[model samples]
Target: MTKGIQNSETPLFLLSMMMENPEAAELCFPQLLNNSCRKPLPPQSDGMLVYIVLSFISLLTVTLNLLVIISISNFRQLHNPTNLLILSLAVSDFLVGLLLMPAEILHTEACWFFGDHMCALNYVVDFIITSSSVGNMVLISIDRYLAICDPLQYTNKVTLDRTKICVCLCWICSVLYNSLILNNFLRHPDEQNSCYGECVVILNNITGTVDFVFTFISPITVIIFLYARVFVVAVSQARTMRSHIATVALQRSVKVTAKKSEMKAARTLGVVVVVFLICICPYYSPTLVGQDIEDSSSSSPFVVWLLYFNSCLNPVIYAFFYPWFRKSIKLIVTLQILQPDSCNAGIM
Candidate 1:
């Protein structure tokens, strides 16, 4: 008799559950619901809390990267070759916050409102931005390596004009490279999408492997090698400065100042490189484990957001380490930039 009673209550329990979540039964598009995507599964935790936290992150990313851009662009003293590379990085990070972060938040919705073309474009843009960011980092590594290891010719090799050209080329090549990688997906925008309202792109084993090598492995190898060389050279220079007692006071004073400036910049950039690799490594871990790279409903939110959170952290690192960056922030916030000859103000 008890078994029979329990069985009878099962239907009521299911009905209550359905009633509580009417959305669960509805398709993403109700008008022609048969082939449409289903709604997202309910969050395991408080959904409102999730939204508030993610929104805050998105806003912070934009705010911090914007400061980096404004500071570099507005202050003439900040317009050196190394800072130009930093400015390029800031642009990419700013876009990540402005565009990719919002799109990632939208992914939580689990049904894309934009049509298929937009979906392909979004992924392509994502790839281009990230690739360009890595390129900028590599350029920065090269700049520092030359400055420290080959200081005599560093000025001649890395000029403001040449850095500008390299930045432009980096962006252009990134677009071309990613567009090539995503050529097929752009051609068939909805090929990987399982449902009408879904937006997904798949990178098969071969394409994924190729992208991993070119985008991740090659660039990282170059970055590590260059920074290592820079580290050794900088250490030697520091030791030389410590051991040597110069007979000429004026010449020694000038040499010490220049060496200290270069070494400091090298240390700061090394921190940036380390933080970048930490944030980026997990996103490519699936490639290592032989998992298909797909943007789908089943994808982990942690992976995507972790990659984007790097951008926000870069500016924070700048603010914390670079006194000039802090000083520039004061000028920008206080609107002293609007005053005459503010761009000529000393930053370094």
Candidate 2:
């Protein structure tokens, strides 16, 4: 009777151990239990809430960016050089929403179902999109600086053709640069994985340092410097316009109109730059403390999500500041775009 009681208690003890240790709950690969990664099993309620929130953000990002793309592409009046740059940005942001966000959500919450090649591809695409976004911000800053400080030459300098060329070059360079930076990972996607059911890519200190400097430090410095000059010139222009308002009526009217346009553009772009900086800085913070700059799969979910959230915020900023965007969105939602000659619609 005692032996029978001990046998029953042994099973109960094993069951209790399994319940207490989270890792024993579920294995991603039951066939090779010890070699496989444990499935991440967050609390049901918390998991549902996280999924709902992140899914909503992802859907919203895709929708908003798609609207921006359609708005600029459909309207002829919106086909200016600045709008073209915005269009490029929207494309990158759209990809982030469609591809990167979902991938990141999975990376944060689930095991890797996709193969090693896919993991490498995902990171490559991520890097390209990120670099392109930064490049576009730098371009927008330069465009604003020229428009404000060199108004007389702005028209000639920032033509649509030149803008198109610059956008193409920016994208091409991003692909090449990121490919070179992450070459090792591309060659061996599973090199850093500790188990059979895991996917990870590790960057050494040297690679991390190089990526930090080129992608973060250099681009941010350029953006800040250009915007600083733009701020000073914009202030000077505002003061000049106020002074001229008292002296010359007709002459100041034309100049004031032009300057105001430039100033307005500067203010709008300034908001975009500031928001971009805010989102991007937290992502680099880990690296600043001598930590290796890991990607979404291995990095802090909060920091990664914060950076991805910037893509969603950008279109919101445009809609708030640009009347044309509001009008375009209205037309789009109303299906007015199906009408004849909608491309010629006067949004501006």
Q: What is the Å distance of residue 33 in model 1 from its true position? A: 3.2
Task: Give TM per candidate.
Answer: 0.89, 0.90
Question: Where does the lowest 10-residue lDDT sum fall in candidate 2?
Answer: 1-10
lDDT of each: 0.85, 0.85
Candidate 1: Cα lDDT at 330: 93
- Best TM-score among the predictions, by candidate number: 2
Off by over 4 Å in 2: 1-25, 245-255
- What is the TM-score (0 to 1) of candidate 1? 0.89
Instruction: Give the per-residue lDDT of model 1 (tens digit) for 101-174.
Output: 88888888557877887888889989999999899989999998888887667779989999999999999999
Task: Give residue 239's error in model 1 in angstroms.
Answer: 1.8
